[model samples]
Target: MRSRYTAYVLGLEDYLLQTWHPDFRPVSLDLAENEQIKWLGLRVNQTALTSENTASVDFIARYKIRGKAERMHELSQFELIENHWYYLTGEMK
Candidate 1:
């Protein structure tokens, strides 16, 4: 999860897509204006795993855009496939 967050902070769209579940993968990722998005930090709020292959992590990411501050709380899901973790989906928390 931290790796994914690092990818996000660095605006590494390729890495993000590579780690995403194919079933939920998008056709493309466009970070055309990512330079304007400032990611401050991420805080893990909660984590739960029902088995060795699946898990959910709730996190709050702080950021700023234009002149306003914002925080996004999202519950992200992950699935382990062939011993590799893949991001499945997420819902706003």
Candidate 2:
């Protein structure tokens, strides 16, 4: 989750796509187009294993767009495949 946050802050779209589960990966990303977005910080609230190969992370990411502050709270799901963890989906709160 932290790595993914860093990826967003760095505009590392390819790294983000690589970490996402292939089945859930988006066709494309427009990170560079959002030039006004400024990532502030990431706060991980909790993490839990739902099963042997599945887990969830609850986090809050703070940022600013066009000089206006905002935050995103989400519970993200991930699955372990072939000993590697890949992001599956997320639910915004």
Highest TM-score: give the candidate number: 2
Q: Which segments of candidate 1 are over 4 A away from where they belong? A: none
In terms of lDDT, the best-performing candidate is 2
Tens digit of per-residue lDDT, candidate 1, span 4-86: 98988888899999999999999878876767779999999999995889999999999888978899999999999998999
Model 2 clash tally, residue pairs:
0
Each candidate structure's count of clashing pairs: 0, 0
Q: For candidate 2, lDDT tens digit of each residue in 1-93?
A: 899999999999999999999999998899877578899999999999999999999999999998899999999999999998899999999
